[model samples]
Target: MRHPTPDPPAPGQESVWDYPRPPRVEASDESVEVWVGGVRVASSTRTLRVLETSHPPTYYLPVDDVVPGALRPVDGATWCEFKGEAAYFDLVGGGTSAPRAAWSYPRPSRGFERLVGHVAVMPGAVDRCTVDGEVVVPQAGGFYGGWVTSRVVGPFKGEPGTWGW
Candidate 1:
């Protein structure tokens, strides 16, 4: 399929189209937080942002940063050619539960070992997510876990008719 024209990024912003195909992992010091059911489930100053072509960044927070007992291992798993097998988790807090709302790579592929012990949540499945105090917009498709923030511009892949992109 032909690629869509990328939206030009404004100053201080990045275009998703410019991200690499194999995906890159970079550490972010920006404060990242995740709230579920009105409960703050996770927060961290140290996060790993996964950047891939056509997708917004997916932030992975360290397990130690998550609130105690907030994540419960659940059934189901998925594989990523780049990241390896991912196990799902149910996020429970404030009397609310989000099944399979989070995932982590127990044993990541070589060169992606930094993903170990870090968890990434689907923004759409949680009550809210923020980066440096800015609320994030979840990537459009239900399947992808990218978080959309003002710093990133996209004709993102999860939107309708973008499956091939």
Candidate 2:
């Protein structure tokens, strides 16, 4: 499948095309929060984000800000060439449960060491997720944890026939 042309970024917005192919992880100062089943499950002012081509940024929260007993380690692992092995975690707390709703890299690759032990939740798995007060739109196709916000412009990946890109 051919890569579709991406939309031009609007003023004050970011174009996913401009994101790097190898992906980059950086500390994010924006406030990131998550709610599930009417309860606040995670809130963090010190989050990190992973940015990659054709994908929205995936925010990772420090384990300290996530409510205790909310994440339960589960079986299964996925590999990312740039980030290394990722382990899944179920979000369970506050009368709600989302299986395999979060993931972390217990031993991230060299450049991604900051992500070790940090959790990045699937926005679709929670009732709501926000970055800097803007509600997050889950990246298309359940596989990627990227969060779309008004500040981003994309002809994103994860849709039908776009995988080979």
How does each model score on lDDT? 0.95, 0.90
Off by over 4 Å in 2: none
Q: What's the C-alpha lDDT at position 159 in model 1? A: 86
TM-score of 2: 0.96
Give candidate 2's whole-model lDDT.
Answer: 0.90
Residue lDDT tens for model 1, 42-93: 9999999999999999999999999999999998889999999999999988
Of candidate 2, the 10-residue stretch with the lowest lDDT total is: 156-165
Once model 2 is optimally superposed onto the true structure by TM-score, how far is the C-alpha of residue 88 displaced, in angstroms?
1.2
| Candidate no. 1 TM-score | 0.98
For each candidate in turn, the TM-score is: 0.98, 0.96
How many angstroms is residue 141 displaced in model 2 relative to the true structure, after the best TM-score fit? 0.9
Q: Report clashes for each candidate as comma-separated counts.
A: 0, 0
lDDT of 2 at 27: 90
